[model samples]
Structure formats: structure tokens, C-alpha cells
Target: MSGERAQPVREQGTEQDADVDADAASTEPEADTDAEPAPVTNGAQSVVRALENAGVEYLFGVQGGAIMPVYDALFDSEMTHVTMAHEQGAAHAADAYGIVTGKPGVCLATSGPGATNLVTGIADADMDSDPLLALAGQVPTDFVGSDAFQETDTTGVTRPVTKQNYFAGDADSVGDLVGEAFALAERGRQGPTLVDLPKDVTQGETDHEPGPARTPDTYRPAERADESAVREAAEAFAASERPVILAGGGVIKAEASEELRRFAIEHEIPVVTTMPGIGAFPEDHDLSMEWAGMHGTGYANLALTMTDCMLAVGTRFDDRLTGGVETFAPDAEIIHVDIDAAEISKNVQADYGLVGDAKAVLDQLYEAVAPTPDADEWRAQCREWKEQYPMTYEAPDDEPLKPQFVVEAVDEATPDDTIVTTGVGQHQMWACQYWEFTEPRTWVSSHGLGAMGYGLPSAIGAKVAAPDREVVCFDGDGSFLMTCQELTVAVREELDITVFVLNNEFIGMVRQWQDGFYEGRHMASEYGWMPQFDTLAEAFGAQGFRIDDYDEVADTVEEALAYDGPSVVDVHVDPAENVYPMVPSGGDNGLFALSEDQL
Candidate 1:
């Protein structure tokens, strides 16, 4: 699931003057209806009402003939629609919007190519458990299997990527289908869901007053943790001398970071996170050992290796975290708490599994158990490890600056509340290791799918949702090139975001692996030619800055942050530099192939 594949290049499209028609209804059902109110018109109009019922403020998409009817409805409605160059950009934006707002971010696309383009972003959301709703305009039911213009099976393509997908056949089904999609997207283990509406369904008249979006009759997310299980888990934690709290993205998804921190503090337990779990607890917390995975901090890995009891919350214990299930936390008795029952003991065997919402379970555990006060010695060892093997890197005294230095500089210049997003690969790993994330919903990335070109579009979405916050996207040269056209979208929307490109001129992470593991042979990892980043940004009407010298980093970052509108900062970094403290694929954290100088 984590294997690399060739990424799709973002396509550039302009409205080619082709057109369509729609039945636009009143935005509201009629404020004061003396006459039998205009029977609420078509399914597209009803769909908008349902979205409002579910509290959707923005719809991200690219306009096309198949989806033109929905766009027509938006003409008279209050809902804001953000236009992107491609459907992929729209879906990525929606994904980030959901991540930041804790709501099912909505996206729309036309049939065929548009829907297919959204597949990767939907897959990214599902892999990361980000809540999202993707709506696609399909061909009419009568034209099924007829090879109609711009026709494709949206449901079939999205089935594997989405949490659930539905094909709405008639106008009457639109409202409830939209509502149900939202509910399924947000409930029990959040993820992306879809409702494919045929063009006929959108244009067809419907008198059925589409009611408010409601939670389904049968589907209800479990909000309460088992009392006995909580008590037992807490007792085990209190009993163990070297208990470590392993928090995953589940903690953030459950909004349980506060409870997690409190539990760790009261019990004097060291805390480590999975890759997607960066912001669950403050990285600077006294008991925090930061992330524990393939590219995790050395001391954090050591903590995982040494722990006697691991109270893991909202984490799936994925391959990256476990390294190899047989050797992972070999000495630790794991107490896994997650909202999804299927995830419990799916990978790593859990001595105790509490299947419920992470926040709910942690709340009960905090109330039920008393911590042992004699964990001072164990706590001291965690602190000692932190001191001995801190995540330290010294910059090279030359041009083409160290990438870590750029991340650190950006972190220092930006406000602590800045929403930082990343495109996958070295920049992402560097940001995770270097940037001190203090708040939840602030660090966003495609951790599961490792999708390139996710940062700029997601940052655009985050900025759209939180207009006042400073959103910085840390992107690699390769990833940036993947969706660079989105900068034009950012400029047109007047989104206040700064995309900092670490120009390494290579597929840096893969090259690093090849160098270390494959006897220094990197065949297809390097890009022989690098794009002129500043020129591209300027062409997109965004302010651009290129910094190659280490001395100018602080000034460049400050200027870029101070810019009034969307901007791009390209910091040319040493192409040969690699992310360190790395555990090779399927290797234990303790068996890291560290840099010779590091060892």
C-alpha cells in the first residue's frame, strides 16, 4: 500500500467554451410563501440545501459540462465555491479543509476524467483517515454502458478509496444521499466518502422537501469506552515501571490530545507518536519523545525499544511504526485503544484492546485510576536519553544550504499558530523532525499515501478555511513541480500562504535509500534538470524568492512571511544531503542505518 508509483502530472485546462443548462431553484425554500412556494426545483438545488444542513461552508471543484447543473445552483446560493485548475487539486484542498476543520470537506467534479482525477486525493484521505465528501456529476441513467460523452463509473472507481460510495440514480435520493455521505465520512474512523449524481438526477425536478442532513438510523459511532477495560488498562499502566504512551493520528482525529497529555503527565509516562500523529501532543512537552517510526528521532526509537508497557491510542500500528511485528516493542505489553474495532490487534498483538473513541477511553481511564508516584527514576531515564541523543544537525558552511536549516528558519520566523503542510518525501520527514508543532490540526501531510503535490493545494484549502492563520507549505522541488499550477489558484483566491520549496533537484528520499541499501546505485531517482521555480511562480502572479546562500535564509524567510499575498520561496538545498536516523524498509527502529558521522 505504501509502495511508490509514478504520480500523475497536474493537467492545465481552460474553459473551452462548451456549455450546458440547469434548473436553478430558490436558494432558500421561500422566506414568506403566500403562493405554493416554487416546489424546491431540482436535485442539484436540494443537494445545496442538504450541504447547508450539514454545515458545509465551501465547495471546492473544477467546473465542467456534466457538473454544470450544480454550478448553476451555486450562482444564486450563498455557498462559496473555489475553482481549481484540476479535480485533483480540488480533492486535495477538500482533504486539508477536513483535516483542519474536523468536518467533511466537500468537493465536486464532472463525470469521467474529473472523477478519475480525484481518485488519488480520495485515496490519500482514506489512507490518512481524513474526513472528506466528493461529489461527481455522472451521465444519465438511460445512457448507462452506452459510452456517452464524458461518461465513467464514479462509484466503481472510488469504491476502494472512499469509506463508502453511492450512485444516486434519481432526483429524490440526492438530499438524503448527501446527508448520509457526510455522516459516514465523519463518524467512527473518519474518511472520504462519495455520492455520484447523474446529470439527469441533478436536472430532474423534485418536490420532496429535502430535510436537514441527519445521522443514519442504524449507523452510530460508539462514544463510550468500556469501563472495565479502562480500569484494567490504567491498572496495567500504573503497575508498569517503564510505561510509554504511543499516540497516533487517532488522538488528533478523536480530539484527545489534551487527555493524552494529562494521562502521560499524571502517570509520568513517556510519550511517542506515529508519523501521522505529530501534533497530538506538543512536541516540546516534558515527557514527549516525539515520533517513533522509520524516520523517527533516535531517542524516541530507543524509548519504544526499552518500554515495558505501551498504552497506544488511536493508532493502527502500521508497518512503518511496527518495523516488523515480531520484534516491535518485544518487551512491552501493549494496551491498544481505538474507535474502529477492526483495527484492534490487526497488526501488533495487543495484550488488552479497548475498542471505543480514544478521547472517551482516555477520559474514563484518567478518572478510574491513580498513578504510581514512584516513577521518578524511570522518567529520569527518558530524560537522559533525550539529552544524550537529541535530534541535532549542523549546517554545512557553503552555498546550496542544508534543507533542515530552511525548515528550522521557517519555524523560527513564522508564528507558532501557523498551519504547516507538506508534500511527501524528504521535506515532509525533515519538517516532522525539525518543526516544533505545538498545536493540533496544525501539521498536515499525506503520511499514508505519500502523495506528491499535496502540499500547495491542501495549504490553499487550510488558508481558505482559516483565513487569519499563517499557512506555510514545505514542498520539495519534485513535488512542487507535480502541482505547481495550483499557485495560480492560490493567487486568484488571494490566499495568504507561502510555499517554501526545498529545491534538491532529485527524488531525494529514494536516492538516499538507493545509496544506503542498493550499493550506491540510483538509477531513476535524480532529475537531470530542475525547473526555474521563481519564474514559474512569477508566471502564476505570485511573489517569488530564490535563496541559495545560508546567510540569506533568515532575511528571505522574513520577507516571504511578510508578503501581502500568496508567495513562493525556493531554497536551493544540497542535493546529496539525506534524511538521517532512518530505519530501512521493514527494519526495526533500533537497527537504523545512521550516517557514519552520526554514529
Candidate 2:
């Protein structure tokens, strides 16, 4: 049921007496059990009841004194609440939930430290255009500038990162503010929104009626590509012997997979996706190529170099995507299409810029261009590139386990439609490399911010959003430990999600740098003390599996996937195994890691 349509029906007779008694007891002194019902319920209770009416099944947050009233109200309500180890975990979970479900995910936090902690997650959602609503409890309105305990200017702090923000001075506005927040967060160019509700306001009461349901203003996303522009693009595409489509996260946001596929197939153009765009095009499709730019496939980079025309859609050409802009695709005439005007020529200058929705733009392009005869020469060239530099991982015969083996096994065991979320580091890259993403929005990760410890919480949110679908987190041991405390949340909520931790006993990325740049002077990256993941999982009341042998990786993953509830699989991988094809920091993309002999 839609949130707007799920308003609760008030029950009639004797229940009102019980509610009245409970309300009376909630406000009266300890000795007075017969005090008249409190003058009115506080804004906190109003907000909680509003959420209940809106059919919110769960909320993620960490408790703080400033927000105690809201927590108290939540305890008395039916909505499930998941407490996180950190505010960032709550924010990331909310972002992931919104991305997976196309609804506004909510995160709650208190003043000062709690509000500041959510900054990274907010910026991440902003950069990636995910829908999220963050409710931050603020200090009382009277203490606005007093530097009072737990007080912070949350509205100011989140202004730049959020699409919209509200600071509630009137308690009666809480419900309407939340409704507006949800609408703004999910509107065009979707992004996070913040609502700062002061503690005093939360505890205050007013006689005003609850505000009417909010209806979001219709947003006509710019316009489709013009006839002339479509004709020009089609002419350029048809004439170029080597052309490619660079798809970005916008493709998934706009749900343009069908149009993208049709356009690519009709023109015999190969498609490459950005990190967030991994699942925008099916990885198994014949025309799909691995990602481009830093850490991209060798063949994809070479193809970018050789291509005569590049059509980029719904993407910002980030430094990672363009390598060094001065030398990237010098021979290619770039045609950029995006809904955001600021991104059109922000980095790499485009030969042509079309501002519009991805699906709408592609629809126009499809209409303008007539289906062409098969490009046998282009297909042959692409086939050669694919065969020569295909992404592959050969497990070492003597190694305990390879992360790629675990990733591949999980991919094979899970259905094609399953959603996969990842934490940053080797495991994230391995999931990108080994997992076959066939549907849009199926692969969720901290692509822009590259935040660690996002996997488990994000998986929790995804499962909540799509309860019928299988959700899994591909995490690293270091990242897992950072946010593993949230496991209790999964157990408490009984969320059906799987967490696969690649336990290598080291920060593999940092170790790789130490080996490459510091000549193997392994500093503080190694962990001499190890936590038993199986025990940790059991403590949280979830099934756990540990695999140390390469041969047992597949069976263990299968077992974890079959578990009815939340489960964790800790697969021990070779500590020395490093993610290769790396573009060294402060260097051009061409200066990638190579063998000592090559160097």
C-alpha cells in the first residue's frame, strides 16, 4: 500500500479509555495515577504517529538525549526501529533503502555529534542522486546560539548537501514538514533532504489541526532531445566507425534500461557504465563492456582511446571516469546528455550537450534514427577487444582463498534479480568485477564518497525496502568490524539479508600501497588480533559460516544463501592478494600498476 493511502482507522469505545489512562499516566507525577489527561501530546508523539499513519514499517537511528522524546514515543508505537552503532550507518541505510525501493528512506539522529556524523552519507546521496529524508533533532529553539549541550546548527550544516531543509519552530508543522521532505527527496534529480526539529518544539503542543496530505508539484524534466539534435547525434553515430555509449547512474535513476538497450542494439554501439551505473546495462549482454577510466578494464580503456565518437548519458565525468582529462579520448567527439545543467561541461568539454531526462532523450534518439545494417567491421573489432582483454581471475593453486572466487560463487548461487550492496575496498572492486548485474538499481554501493562500513547497513535497508527480494552485502573484514555492531539490528528486526565478509586479516588496499610505494614496509595496516566472526554472528542470533579453503568457498556461500534469516559468511582470503589494474594516486590513468619486469 502507498504511504498516503494507509492512514489508520481510529477504533471506537473502551480503547479510548485505555489510551486516556495511558496518556494521563505518561504526564502525571509518580504519585498521581488519576491526573487529568495531559493538555496535549508533544510534537514527537505527533511525528511518530504520523509515520505510523504513513505506514512506515521501519526507521534507522541512534538514540541521543536531545531526541529522547521521539525515542520514547517510538517505544510506545508499533514501528520497528533499528539502532545503529553510528549516525553514518543509519544515514547510509536510509540512502540504500530509498535507492532500492524508489521511496524516501528515513534516518533520525540527535543534535551536534549525531547530526555531524550524517554529513558523509548525505553528501554521498547528493552526489549519486538517491532519495533520503534525514530527521535531526535539534537543541531547543531558545538555545539556538547559546552553545548549549548537544546543540548544533543542523540546518546550516546540511544545506549544501541536501536538496531541501526545514527547521521547525511550530510543533504542529512536524507532520506536514515530513511529508514535504519525502516529496522533495524523491522529486526530480532525487537527493537527500533534512528536517531539523527542535527539542522544545518536539515537547510543545498546539491546538492546530494536522496539516493536509502533501502533493508534490509536477516536475517536467527539461525536455526530450530536439529533432535537430537527435538527427545530429544519429548522423554522428552512424558515420563513426567506432562509437560507444558511456552510461552513468542517471540511467538507472531514470529507469532507461529498455531505451538504452534498444538504442545500443540498433546502432551496434557498445555500452560502458560508471561505478554507480554498473547494473544500468546487463553485464551479460553482448554489447556491454566493463567500466571505463581508473580501475577500468584494459580493453574498455583502449576502446575509449580508439573510439571516434563518445555518447555520454546521465553521468558527470568525474576525475576517475576521465583519468587525466587532458589526454582522455582526444580523438573522440563527446556528446553529453544530462538533466543537470552544471554537469554538462564541468570537466571534459562536450562537442554537443543535450539537457533532458535520459529515457526521454533516448526515446527521441530512437525515433529519429532508422535501424541500420549490421556494422560487421565494428562488431568484429569489438569482439577482438572482448576476447583479448576479458576480465578474469585465476585462483592461485597454493593460496588459501581468493576474494574473486568467493564473489563469483555468491554471484552464481544468488538469482540474477538479487540485489548486491558493497563496502569500499577490495571486496567492493571484486563484486564489481565478478558479479553479473543484470537489472537497474540492483547494485548499490558508496560510489561517490567511497565510504567504508556501508555494506551491512545498506543491505539491511535494501532488505527492508524489497522484502521479497534477496539482498546481500559483499564486505571486507576491516569494513565489517567498523559497523558490525548493527548486526544486532538485523537480529532484532529479523531482516532476511546475507553478509559476506572477505577476511584477509589486513587492510588489503593499504597493504598494497605499502608494498608498492613503501617497499613492503607493512605499517599499521595488519591486525594481529582477530575477532571470531562466527562467534560474533552467533552472538547476534544469526547463522554464521567460516571458510578457509578455496574448494569450500562455493559450498559455504550456498549454505549461507539458503539460511532463512540473516547470515554472515566470513571467507578467509590470502592477505597478499591485491586488487590490480590500479591507477596510482596523483598519476595519470595510463600510469597503472605493472609487473616489476615491465617497470
RMSD values for the candidates in order, in angstroms, are 7.0, 7.2
lDDT values, one for every candidate: 0.85, 0.80
Best by TM-score: 1
TM-score of each: 0.93, 0.87
Candidate 1's error at 575, in angstroms? 0.8
- The alpha-carbon deviation from the true structure for residue 38 of candidate 1, after best TM-score superposition, in angstroms, is 6.7
Error of 2 at 345 (Å): 0.6
Worst lDDT run of 10 residues, candidate 2, spans: 1-10
Q: Give lDDT: candidate 2, residue 85.
A: 66
- The best candidate by lDDT is 1
